[model samples]
Structure formats: C-alpha cells, structure tokens
Target: MRLLVTGGSGYLGAAILKRAPATCELAATYLAHSIAQGNAAAFRVDVRDADAVNHLFDEFRPAVVMHAAAQMTGDQMLAVNGDGSRNIARAATRVGARLIHLSSDVIFDGEHAPYDESAPPNPISPYGESKARAERVVLDELPRAVIVRTSLIYGFDPLDPRTRQTLNGEMPRLFTDEYRCPIFVDDLADALLELAQHEFVGVLNLAGAQRLSRYEFGIKMANAFHAAPRFTGALSASYPGRRPRDCTLDISLAQKTLRTRLRGVDEVLQDLPGF
Candidate 1:
C-alpha cells in the first residue's frame, strides 16, 4: 500500500510510522521537525496551505491517507484543524485515496456519556469545535472517509505530552471529574493501520476499553513511571473555561469489527516492569 501520514513528527504519527508495515511505501508530512523512521520518506508541507497539500498529494499519490495533522489549541486551531482537514480531504478525493481522519472525543458536550458512533457532535470548547468542524468538512469532501474518533493517546516509549507534563510538575491539578478512555498509543496505531486496508467508512469510536478520570489516569502514569504522584485532584468546575466532564467513548463497534485489541490504560501500565 502507498500510505501518507500527516503530522509525522507528532506522537501518534511517529508511532504509526514506527509500526507501519515494511511492504508499504510510506510518506509523511511535517510542518517543522522532520522525521527519519526506517524507509519512510518525510516531506515538509503545511497542511494549512491548500496549495501545498494538493501539491504533495499530487506528487505522492498515496493509496491511503492518514490525516493526523491538527492544531489542538491557540489562535490557529480552526485554520489548522478545520480548514487543513478540508484541504486534505479534497486532495485525497482527487487522488482517490482512502482517507482515515483522526478526530477527538472532545467533540461531544460531555453531558452525554459513553458516546457511540451515531452520537452527534455538540462541542463545548474551541478545541472540540475545531475537531467537529474538521469532521464535517472531511465528510463533506470525502463521504467514504473513515472518521476515527479517539481519546487520550498515551505510551511509555517516549512519554506522551499529558503524562510528561504531569511528571515535570507542569500540571498543578488533574481533573477528577473529567472522564476519558485513554488508549495506548501502540493500540491506536495498530487499529488505524488495520482500518487502512479495510473498506470501513463513516464515524468509528476507537478508544480504550476502560474509562477513568484524568486524575486517576495521572496517578496511574506516575505509579508506572516510578515517580511520586504529586498532582492534586480538582473538579472540572475549577477549570477556567468550559470543559467536557465525560467524553468517554463506547468502542463496542470497534471491538466487534477489528482484530486489534484496544487495551486500557491500566492494562497498558501493568505492562511496565515492576508495576
């Protein structure tokens, strides 16, 4: 398969590159930091620029496109996540490539618990709104595209951002009420690869089997890291802006469909030595 992965420098993108099949012709795009994983060719292209995206798509002409490039926050969120997604979708459509766009659980308002594939997006925050918009544009451009909505992607190989922040004492308080199904990065990568070959389209919730609060996830990470967990628990209300309280996903469809086992955070943590 000729595969193209955007945001190759990001955590999940890097993991995918590392685990992708050797038989596949791999190509990845990054805005700044370039990657050198195996034989995967890295291209520096800004997804925000439609011309650049189209040019890369024309050159690579991938059989499958994993659109992982996104801006989670700040002023460029909408432009990067929403408009960038539209550009990728249109480019992939032109090339007749199977598009598997990564989405987030934050799209829901959190008033709804254990969201399934059919759950309509009711974003509460800017990040969520941007992702929801990304989903809409991607679907509009490529109706057959697989919109994979996932949760907190964590891995120990090169500690994920959230866990690293907590370990470095950058996070003062972890939310006790905010619930999510944090998937192991490896599991998510494997699942995405499996999805690439399949004909499955539309929204698919691919998250961890277990759901837990952010505080619980942090404590587990600290314990697994063999560091003293120091962060205090705080309710979502204490958070400055509106935060999703229960963005937990229902991965029953994914569980039933794919052979890839989506392990939970607890199971993943236990895989560590002396855990």
Candidate 2:
C-alpha cells in the first residue's frame, strides 16, 4: 500500500512515519522544517497551498492520504486548523485518494463524560473549532473518509522540544483539572493505518482508555521514565481561552473494529523500559 502523510516532520506525523509498516510505501510533506532522513520519500508541500497540495498528490498518486498536517497552536489554530484542512480535503478528493483526517477531542466541550462519535461538537477554543470544521469538510466532501479524533498525544521524539523539556526536568508541571485521554503516538498511528483499510467512515474517537488529568499523566510519565519531577495542578478556568473540564473519549467502536487495542495509562506506563 502507498500512503501519503502530511506534516511528515511534525511530532505525531513523524512518529506515524517511523512506526508505519515497512511493507507499505510512504511519501510525506514537510513544512517549516526539512524532512528527516528515512526510507520514505519526503516533499516540501504546504497544506494551505492548494496548488502545492495538488502537485504532491499528482506526483505521489497515493492510495491513502493521511492528513496529519495542520496549523496546530493556540495562537494560529484557527487559520491553520480550519482553512488548511479545507484545502487538504479538497485536494485529496480531486486526486481520488482515500483520506484519514486527524481530528481532536477538543471538538466537544468537556461537560460530558466518555464522548462518542455521535456527540455534537461544542468547541470551546479556536483549536477545537478548526478541527471541528475540518471534520465537517472532509466528511462532506468524501463520505468514505476516516476522521480520527484523538487527545493529548504523548510519546518519545528526540526532535520535539516539549518531550525534551519533560525529559530534562525543565517543564514538568501539568494541569490537575485538565482531564483528557492521552494516546500514545505509536498506538494512534497503528490505529490510523488500520482505519485506512476499513470501510468505516465518519468521526471516531481514538484515545487512551483512561481519563486522566494532566497532573496524573505527568506523574505516570515521570514514574515510567524514572524521572520524577514536581507537578502543579491548576483549574482550567484560570486559563485564557474557554476549555472543558473533562473530555475523555469512549473508544469502544474502535476497539471492536480495529486490529490494535486502545491502551490505558497503566498499560502505557508499564510498556516503558525502566518502569
């Protein structure tokens, strides 16, 4: 199988590329940073640029296009998340390639517990709004598209500064009340690849099994890595933008359908080498 991954240089995208099966041919686009050296072919294409997206699709002619690239930040989330997604969906549709759009749990306000695919979107932040919009566009344009909504992704990546800080004890503080289902990047990538082969369409919540506050996740990380660091808990209301208190997802559908199982925090932590 030939696959095209956008944001090939990003934390999650790069992880996906690294974990993908060797039997599958991979091509990807990098923005802001140069592509990492690997067996996969990397191209410099901006998802925001329709022409560039089309050119890459035409050149690669991938059977599956994983749209993992987005303008992902609290500041520029709207422009990059919403508009950039629209361009990618359109280009993918034109190329006759199946799309697997990565979305976020932020799309739903954290008021409800164990959100499912049918839960109505109640985005409280610009980032959430953009992802929600992207979901709509991709599904509307291509009914066969897979929309995987994940949360608080964490994994090892030497190039990622956030991971570096956590490992170095520079920034170990986490929000106590900001609960989310954090998925391991490798597991998510495996699930996405499996989803790409299935007939399932529409939105699917692909997150960890456990609902954990940021503080708890930090503790688990520290314990797993044998790098215990001080953690700080804060209320979500104290933050600038509006945020949901708890937005854990129910991955029952994913568990029933996909080959890979959604792991809990304990499972993830135990998998750590030194834990």
Candidate 3:
C-alpha cells in the first residue's frame, strides 16, 4: 500500500513513518523540518497552499493520505488551528484520496466526562472552533474521510528539547487541577495506520483510557523515567481563557474496531521499557 503523510517531521507523523510496514510505499511532505529516516520519499510543501498540495498529490498519487499537518500555538489556538486545517481538507478532497485528518478533544466544552463520536461539538476555545470547522469541511467534501480526535499526546523527543523539558519538569508542575487523557505518540501512530486500513468514517476519539490530572500524570511520568516528581497547584481560572474541566474521551469505538488498543496510564507505563 502506498501512503502519503503530511507533516512527516511532526511527533505523530514521524512515529507513524517509523512504525509503518516495510512493504508499504511511503511518501511524506513537510514545511519546516524534514524527517531523515523513512522508507518513503519526503517533499517540502505547505498544506495551506492549495497549488503546492495539489502538485504533490498529483506526483505521489497515494492510495491513502494522512493529513496530519496543521498550525498550532499555545497562546493563540484559533488562527492556525481552525483556518489552516480547512485548507488542508480542501486539498485532500481535490485529490480523491482517503484522508485521515487528526483532530483534538478541545472541540468539546469539557462539560461531559467521556465524549463519543456522536457527541456534538461545543467548543469553548478558539483552537476547538478551528478543529470543528476543519471537521465540517472534510465531511462535506468527502464523507468517507476519517476525523480522529485525540488528547494530551505525550512522548519523548530527542530532537525537541521543549518536549523533553515539558515531560521532565514544566508538564508535571502544571498538572494539579488540569485533567486529560494522555496518549503516547507511538501508540497513536499505530492506531492511525490501522484506521487508514478500515472503512470507518466521521469523528472518532482516540485517547488513553484513564482520566488523570496534570499532577497525577506527572507522577506517572516521573516514575516511568526515574525522575523526581514536580507539581504545583494552579486554579483553572488563573489561565487567560476558558477551558473544559475534563476533556478526556471514550475510545470504545477505536478499541473495538482497530487492531491497536488504546491503553491507560498504568498500562502504558507498564509497557514502557526502563530508560
């Protein structure tokens, strides 16, 4: 099977490239950083540029296209999150290729405990609004397209110092009142590939099984990595914008349909080899 992955250098995309079957013909595109190791060919293209995206699509003619590229920001989530995704969706539709678009749990207002694919999006943040809009474009353009909504992705990155620091220090400290279901990037990559093989369509929540506060997750990370635990309480109100109290998702659909099982914190930690 030939597959094209956008955002090939990203955390999830890179992991997917690494885990994909050796027989699969892989082609990837990136805007900023390029992944050096993969069986697939890599191209530098901006997803927002329809012409550029189309050019690559025509050249690759992939059986499956994983649209993982998007613009994101910690301070401003809407501008890149919502608008940028729409552009990618448009290009994916134009190519008549099966698309698996990555989405986020932020689409929900965080009122409910565990949301399903049927849950109506009631986004409270600009970032959420962007993903909601992106979903609409994909469904409208291609009903067969899959929208995977995941949350709190955690993994170690040798090249990304920020990710390392966040996992080792800042992330644990932020976790007091904040709660989320964190999925490991490796597990998520496997799931995405499995999802690509299925005929599943529409929004599917891909997340870990357990609901943990930032503090609890930090403790788990520390234990897994043999690092000292660091946590400090912070009120949700202290943040600049409104956020859902608990945005964890229920991944029963993915677990039942896909080969990769969505694991909880304990399960994931147990699987983690000593490093």
Task: Give each model a TM-score.
Answer: 0.98, 0.93, 0.91
lDDT for each candidate structure:
0.92, 0.81, 0.78
lDDT of 2 by residue, 1-275 (tens): 88999988888778778878888899988978976739689998867777887888889888898988887576767666677777778878888888899998988888987799899989887778888888887777787788898988887654245545665767646678888998888788889888777888777889998889887887777666666665566676777778878898989988888889788878976776755
- After superposition, candidate 1 runs with Cα above 4 Å error: none
Q: Give a tens-digit lDDT track for model 1, residues 92-118.
A: 999999999999999999998989999
| Tens-place lDDT digits, model 3, residues 170-203 | 5534636667898888789899998888888877
Name the best candidate (by lDDT).
Answer: 1
Clashing pairs in 3: 82-130, 175-214, 175-215
Q: How close is candidate 2 to the true structure, as a TM-score?
A: 0.93
Worst 10 residues of 1 by lDDT: 266-275
Instruction: State residue 188's C-alpha deviation in candidate 3, in Å.
Output: 0.9
Which numbered prediction scores highest in TM-score against the true structure? 1
TM-score ranking, high to low:
1, 2, 3
Worst 10 residues of 2 by lDDT: 156-165
Q: Which parts of model 2 are misplaced by more than 4 Å?
A: 157-163, 167-173
